[model samples]
Target: MLRRIDEALINRANQSLLNELEADYAALGDKLARQNIDIEAITRSAADFQIAVPSWGTGTGGTRFARFPGTGEPRNIFEKLEDCAVINELSGCTDSVSPHFPWDKVDDFSELKQTADEYGIKWVSVNSNTFQDQPGQEHSYKYGSLSNTSKEARELAIQHNLDCIGYGQQLGAKSLTVWVGDGSNHPGQQHFQRAFERYLASMEQIYKGLPDDWEMHIEHKMFEPAFYSTIIQDWGSNILAAMQLGPKCKSLVDLGHHAPNTNIEMIVSRLIQFKKLGGFHFNDSKYGDDDLDSGSLHPYQQFLIFNELVDAEYRKEQDFNPAYMLDQSHNVTDPAESLINSAIEVQRSFVKALLVNREALYGYQEDNDALMASLELKNAFNLDVSPILAMARYRKGAAINPLAVYRSSGYRSKMAELRPRDPNATGSGIV
Candidate 1:
């Protein structure tokens, strides 16, 4: 693999931390042994965990107010792959990148795939963007795209999604994720039933273009751009659309796209029950789609979601596999560092979930011991899994402390020299 960070530097950094990390691992293993849990098995599972990085997030993200671009921000898809490579090289968890259309479009997809392969990266779900109009576009998405009452606009949107699938096929991607900002900003502006009908009609055309082995992931958001209501506003609408589409279509859950205090874990369970959970766009949020880093806040909630995922794994539910990807906006920190940290945070949650005493928890639930059931969950959550995560990375030839090694490597400073900033460039208001 072509590693962006120096192997010698990572070796030295790991050597410095190895003794202490080993001690911690031994202690944790002993603790888990008392509970009859093999820490090695959990560590191996952690080593195997992977998540996809959002290509757009390699650049600094912004809000509606302003975008303060970071130094060495990726200017194009190729540069974005370079940054993604660094993330994977250091963290060893993000092996694929989910790309958005037009922003990542290039003339030669074969070359793009080769470049990604050189960096040991692959493509995940290809996302379609009809929320905004591209330069010289015929129709304006200002009204709507897929759900637009205008035939021209709807046709253009459907074509865009079909094109995305075509691009994904060249890049070895197996899924297409569709998230549109098509709805009404005020009451009585759009007829809800009619708008949804149009959306389904448009999606049906796109669905036909999907390859036999491919999936179509529908992502729903509560409200954005269209404040009054969003066509596919919640899981209800998302799953309904998925069911209507067929077996190849499924619902994608973005962690930030929900009302505050919503029982997202229950939503995961319900999706699993119906075998419609396609994947997740992992990120944290205080309110609305803040797009904060993964597990930056309410880590317990992230852990709970993973608990349900692990539970599904244990039960061997039919077609239980779900794709994992990080979708966050780095407005205040280095995007590379933030991605590395977020990957670790997500991996931490997965490992903790693996540690859960499922049999004991089930017994507690069966006995109706609420307090003990809660305690059982808390016990797994509270156990520090840092050693296990570090060990996994170490064994895989990645950094033991990725952030620390990245900082010491001065990679960002070097990239700043290689990739000068473009003062006239506009920001994408998202990551």
Candidate 2:
């Protein structure tokens, strides 16, 4: 009887979604017809956009000051997978999960792989933790990890990355993401050149250990943990390190990793031009690395980034594919709901970017009409594509109103009942 109610609710929601899609396509089709573009092709491509959810994002996220864990938060990787499944089932966008090592480590990885498979989740990228000290560790990364002046500390960091690659291999993951808190906090605290050299030396060993088909993702942060400087502090540093390391190495752009008002889209364009763009750690920030959900603070900026990406696909034909994974930490909002919403917001930007009339924009550029070209981009952005997103999810057997569905299903309450909170327990990773 309860199953029937669930089915009925889903069916009604899907039908409404289809109606909305029809209306949107009809409207957007008129705009596309001006350029003689095929609307169906746009929808088809939009349907194919998929992003990966971070395992750590499934739990409550906090700042260095304090963390407030939510009810039914996933206590382990298995629990995290269950939460990730809910996001995918609703959004129809996040089909993969990126796991952070040690934080998400599991015994019997084969079992872990099988469990994830059961939930229709695939591993995206495996992130290694070398920023903090581990239990029973011989050395501390208090000052640094790969860039540590201590040879033992550097070696420890290198071994951890290698182990992560091995674990990724078992899960059929083809990438390892490495980010380090290796920098000096005070002026004249350390030698920058020597530190980076040590980091490179440490990275060489990890890069060599990667399987031939695998890629190494180097994430750069402008600051945090290190007040004065970070080893891989910006795109220039990231790309330079990638170039020095070899072909399989690429730069990862975490949206929150840059300084405020940075031209991230330009950086993305440059990276793609160099064919060294590895992937993304999607998030938003008002100031430094806030780790807010993607598209929350700057939807337009997100749209612009997608504009460059879609432009690359349409014009450059670069055979370059950047992995998309969310790296956000939400202190408020239910993690599952936040993830689902973030995924949709990203998809919204994608759909808007797809609507850009490329041929017209090109013509405008050729004619040296900068204003009109900018207008061409804005025209698409102005059009609301909620209906189109609704349509795509409905077609894919996902929820039209994912949040509503989740609430109606009482999944969170059920999770709380089944998995109870641990008041005495604490967790690792970003606050």
Candidate 3:
């Protein structure tokens, strides 16, 4: 594979931190051994853990109010792949990228695949966008798209999803994610039943187009662009639609898509119970879909979600595999830096989750010792896993300190000269 950053720079960066990392890692191993936890096992899990980065997130993201462009942002899909490569090279956790339609559209699939291959990256889920209309388009999704009252608009939306699947097939993507901004501002403006029926009909057509091995992921959001009601507003509606579609259809959870203080971990447990959970779009939020970096605002919440996931893993839950991906917006910081740090934050949560004494926690639950059970979780969360994460990256031939190495390489400034700035560039809003 072609490398965007020099190996020598990474080696130098690691050399500076090597002794310190080794000391910390040995200390951590001894500490974990006291609790009967093998640090090597957790390190292996951390090394193997992977998450897909959103293609659009490589650029500067903005809110509906305004966008402040970042210097040297990717100009197109190829450039985006270049940036994604840098991320994977340093963090070693993001080897795949989830692409959005139209924004990543290209004429030659073969060449696009070749370019991605050179970067040592592959396509994850291909996201379909029917929320907004394209220039010179016949349909206006202002009212709705898949769930539109107009047959023409709905058909157009369906065809777009079908096209996305075709593109995904060529790009070696095995799933298609559909999230539409189709709802009403007024309570009675939309006939709820009929709109959902239309949505089902349209989705059925798209489902039929899925390859034998590919799955269909339906992403649900409560409100945005539509205030009063959204078609697939909650997990209940998401599961219903997934069931209606079939086994290949599953629900995707965006962490920021739910109402404030919702029991997202319980929702994850329930989705795993029924095998309806497909994957997640990982991000942090305080108010609404802020799309802040992963674990930035709610590190504990992120850890708890991973706790449930690791519990499911320990039990060997039936058909419990869920895709992991980061979906966030970088408005103020450099996009590449934010992605690398976010990937590490997520990996930290996974390592910490693995540290949880599940057997003891279960015993506490059986004895109705609520305090002990909560304390069990708290103990694991309190343990620092930074050494494990750094060592994992180091062993994988990646940077021990990804952010530091990236800055030393001067990648952003180099790209700034390579690709001129675009004054009118925009990104997927807030997410």
lDDT by residue for model 1 (61-109), tens = 8988678898988889999999999999999899999999989999999
Query: Would you list the rank order by TM-score, best first?
Result: 1, 3, 2
Model 2 score (lDDT): 0.87
Per-candidate alpha-carbon RMSD to the true structure: 1.0, 2.4, 1.4
TM value for model 3: 0.98
Model 1, clash count?
A: 0
lDDT of 3 by residue, 145-168 (tens): 999999999999999999999999
Pairs in steric clash, model 2: 62-431
Work out how many backbone clashes candidate 2 has: 1
lDDT of candidate 1 vs native? 0.95
132-167 per-residue lDDT for model 2 (tens digits): 787999999998999888889888899999999989
For model 3, name the residue pairs that clash. none
The Cα error of candidate 1 at residue 129, in Å, is 0.6
Question: In model 1, which runs have C-alpha deviations exceeding 4 angstroms?
Answer: 427-431
Candidate number that wins on TM-score, 1 or 3: 1
Q: How well does candidate 3 score on lDDT at residue 390?
A: 94
